[model samples]
Target: MELPVVKYNRSHYIETDTGNKVSRKSVIYGSQNITLSGKTIIQAGCVIRGDLRRAGGGQTLVIAIGRYCLLGENSVIRPPHKTYKGVFSYYPMKIGDYVAIGENSIVEAANIGNHVQIGKNCIIGRFAIIKDGCRIEDHTVIAPNTVIPSFSVYSGSPGRLVGELPECAPEMYEARSKEFYSKFMAT
Candidate 1:
């Protein structure tokens, strides 16, 4: 399938044949440590920090982003950090497919499952595990080490389970993501 393209000043962000559109303005560190499956979009001003390797690491992957994912503008995705046995260490971050992270959000999650939508200006704390088919409302603040069940909607300062997602959430999310990608082209 042919992915869409978005236009910028003179330089355009083209979706590659593999279905990835990475903005030139985005900051990606340790590219070797970050794996993008395919059909992923990293918007302008987004910062993905893969440079922070694991403690006692010998060439380990830090960040893994799945296919059909969209990271909004100015968002920050980084591995969660903690002190282990008196030594500060950074763990890996895993994000699943068809996930959309809204603008200006900070994600330090250990795992974000497929078909998840995280709204703008949110803060996902370290080691937080967000299951599949979940929706995180805008400006929500998820506490550290929190575990969110699948097929649910979360919101608020401490991120509570506000509602549950429909059984067809995965299909709906897939369609929405594809549609968004298709319309992300420059006029």
Candidate 2:
């Protein structure tokens, strides 16, 4: 899909050497625990809570956003936590390359694989695992601990398996993400 040109105020963002564009209006707490690989765009009003780390540990990585990813405006990317064997700890959240999370979404997934697209206003529950080439439709609510297989499309409140995607989904999604990044201009 071809995305329209979207422009932002130049002074409101910081463009890094590796093509990362981070909005100043975004709230990224405990930034030390968050990792942006390269060419990642984090839009305004986004909140990345990296302070929530694993117990009995140092300042380890909590959230890792892979290369060429997009975290849309007003979205929240938080690490998932739970009590495992009487020890409460926050698990690591990994979002693979070429992932695009739409606006106003709240994601607490443990692992989101490559070329995944999560639509607007979605809520990905804690510990949910989304495999490669998967698409979660808008307004969907993924159940906690749910595992979405590769090349699948999920939708609705419970985020059931809607359909399967073509084998070329990875290449298509990758192109889309790169195109979106290239068209993200500062005006």
Error of 1 at 26 (Å): 0.6
Q: Each model's TM-score?
A: 0.92, 0.97
In model 1, the runs with Cα more than 4 Å from the true position are 1-10, 14-17, 55-57
lDDT of 1 by residue, 36-142 (tens): 99989899999999999875747889999998899999999999999978989999999999999999999999999999999999999999999999999999999
Off by over 4 Å in 2: none
The candidate that wins on TM-score is 2
Q: Which ten residues in a row have the lowest lDDT in candidate 2?
A: 53-62
Supply candidate 2's per-residue lDDT for 11.
100
The lowest-lDDT stretch of 10 consecutive residues in candidate 1 is 1-10
lDDT (Cα, tens digit) per residue for candidate 2, span 61-95: 88999999999999999999999889888889999
lDDT of 2 at 68: 97
Query: For candidate 2, what is the TM-score?
Result: 0.97
TM-score of 1: 0.92
* lDDT score of residue 173 within candidate 1: 91
